[model samples]
Target: MNTRSQTPIPNVDDTTGEYATFARVQVDRWRDGQRETVEDVVAEEVPIALEYNGISHAVMMATPADLEDFALGFSLTEGIVATPGELYECEIVPGCEGVQVQMRIATERFVALKEKRRNLTGRTGCGLCGAETLEQAVRHPKAVAQGGAQFTVQQLHAALEQMQARQQLQQATGATHAAAWMDAQGGIVLVREDVGRHNALDKLIGALAEAETDFSQGAAIITSRASYEMVQKAATVGIGFIAAISAPTALAIRLAEETDVTLVGFVRRQGHVVYARPHRLR
Candidate 1:
């Protein structure tokens, strides 16, 4: 509905194109008589405003990549709409302030959305926002249906290692988080990264939806702590297991137990602790 010009932000350089012109430099610390330069890379944060059916919903500041997935994932995880098809259309309107993601949803869903609107006053460190109450913060989804999602110890270890290797942004900026989905055989099939941990998971979910990947037969691996919200998001996708590199909160553990999603925490180089639903892991 709105139109504006958009410019690309430079992040990767491989000796091709304009980004290649900037040469790497080395810097040294000098007290008083020398000058030096440090090798540096630049990243930009763009504001993304989500509007549902001509009504303003929420805005987020994130790296301007995989926007379509971001929009769809946000809508589904935030409960704006049940499925991606509920979003009739989505367009990116660029402005000096930020990129506005204008989304059109079903009329009935829009009416439901307006009632849940809250004044999100500040930028969120994570992609989660606009919750007016504490109960909303801990919104729970039905537990995943246990089918035949069983993983061996060897497969679990391999999935964790694969997830680590797929963190390209973390390797570059050292400031991003990643969430990955691994299939039953333990191969990391899809990985998403973002400045926000929740956003990374959302993007992963969105990508899965777009690619039509089957989540019922795999697990979700994250590079951060397993919080209650994280557990909820994983459960929303019907993931049978969630393995994290950090500890799980009490709420997260409780939700995992209730949802029947296997929760594994403290996943490190060689060991991990299964907090809940250990039956999924062999």
Candidate 2:
């Protein structure tokens, strides 16, 4: 099978042949002296190559868990396939170098995906690709239905806090991002984390779809900056509102306005800035 490779979690100490190490530190104790310590750990990245009808499309570095979600979400967001059913098969093949995700889409979708392909390349952090122009790079998704979503400022504030508290991988590595679903009652119902911000949001969408959650009745809370693609993804999945812990880019704001997505940025413990579609939030 065609495969893609990514960096695996490296071993910290050769003594145990494991991904851990020991450290010694000098401490000025009143009654005791310095001490030595040991810790066990591993680092893993999600390396996935998207193949459509057996042709390689793109490879991304992400957290190697929930790969089925990653494949489906990426396919949907990138316009590779119109619906999840277009993707017929997916599998993860582990290798000595990294994990290779193989996906097979319908023949019709594969042809369309091939025609839309560009010479674009991806780095560890890049999300948008295959765009021939700046405008294409920021293609706006259709507006989401407002659909009776109403939440007080207090509820939004509480939801942001709840999303932050649920980011377990971010707390552990300080290197991951999270996307969460919050009900009008300020309760977070679902959360997904990943090394890549886009992947985190994709995982959340996949999880919501898998659970048959009612996304139109709630909002999405993200623990990262709001980007144009992020806004597009939320809107694509029929989310009416999105709250982020950081600022939204100008393009992101424009897209949110066109897409009828309520965009809130600079969200803190007490307040937030509404950039677009404020009507959704009461």
Candidate 3:
């Protein structure tokens, strides 16, 4: 892939003010009997350095949009902060190299983060990196409240359709992942996209918290396979339902069961497989 782009430029639409998350690049296309140069749009992936109280923490490859949500959500889900209030300020600084999310969190939370030594070099495809200990590598989340929300199969299908329709970035680039929040009636309320699946989920989680929505009252829909980290993030925020467009890892199933989350995978228009707490789907 010899595609080239500038440092994740944010092109805002004049009317809607929606950030353009893709970059136009020139590429060679080989068809059945032809080869030609063409202009294409690719999802933007850039290094996002997260700084806490001026201390550099993890550097991740992610799409540079909704970064404020990403910082807050990452802080909360990663156990750096117990509540949203613990995070006082989030500032995004874009540079020629990449983007930086400068966050000022509660003193106690920042102190705890330093104690864990959780410095990471994260890629778009992987979440865990630079963990020095087994305990730090695989941390468990608090168990979510049991038996909170239920969704019918029809609602699941409807939400899946809605989410797919709403993913403008994926439609444009086909290189991004989406995470959405589905209300109790299966209406897709909020969606976030990123080059990294975990980043998308973190954005959605952060947006939900910022909107003051009850995490336990709805479900999360992801366009990627469910990993243990995904389950942990959702459970940490008390989301009881998680539906993935692909399969679930064994570790994800185990964590979902332990956290009282209803995990569903291979979600399509016709069917889905429930990996845990099947009763949540009627």
Alpha-carbon local distance difference test for all models: 0.77, 0.75, 0.90
Using TM-score as the yardstick, the better of models 1 and 2 is: 1
Model 1 local distance difference test score: 0.77
RMSD in Å for model 2: 6.1
**Winner by lDDT:** 3
lDDT ranking from best candidate downward: 3, 1, 2
Q: Between 2 and 3, whose TM-score is larger?
A: 3
Model 3 lDDT at residue 83: 88
Candidate 1 pairs with clashing backbones: none
TM-score for each predicted model, relative to the true structure: 0.85, 0.82, 0.94
Model 2 C-alpha lDDT per residue in residues 58-93, reported as the tens digit of each score: 777777667788778777777677676777898866
CA RMSD, predictions in order? 5.2, 6.1, 2.9
Candidate 3 matches the true fold with a TM-score of 0.94
Cα lDDT tens digits for candidate 3, 1-282: 867875334454456765557768999999998999999999877789999999999999898899999998999889899889999999888766777899999998889889987789998878688889988878888888867778899999999999999999999999999999999777998999999999999999999998888898899999999999999999999999999999999999999988889999999979889999887899
Instruction: Kindly list the per-residue Cα lDDT of model 1 for residues 1-282, writing each as its tens digit.
Output: 657644443323545422221223365646588766666543445667878777777777676667788888878877778887888898977666667789999999888887776644226455346577877767888878877478987888888888888877677667677899888777988888877777788888888877877778888889899988888888887777899999999999999999898999998877999999899888
List candidate 1 stretches off by more than 4 Å: 1-36, 121-124
> Model 3 RMSD to the real structure?
2.9
Pull out the clashing pairs in model 3. Answer: none
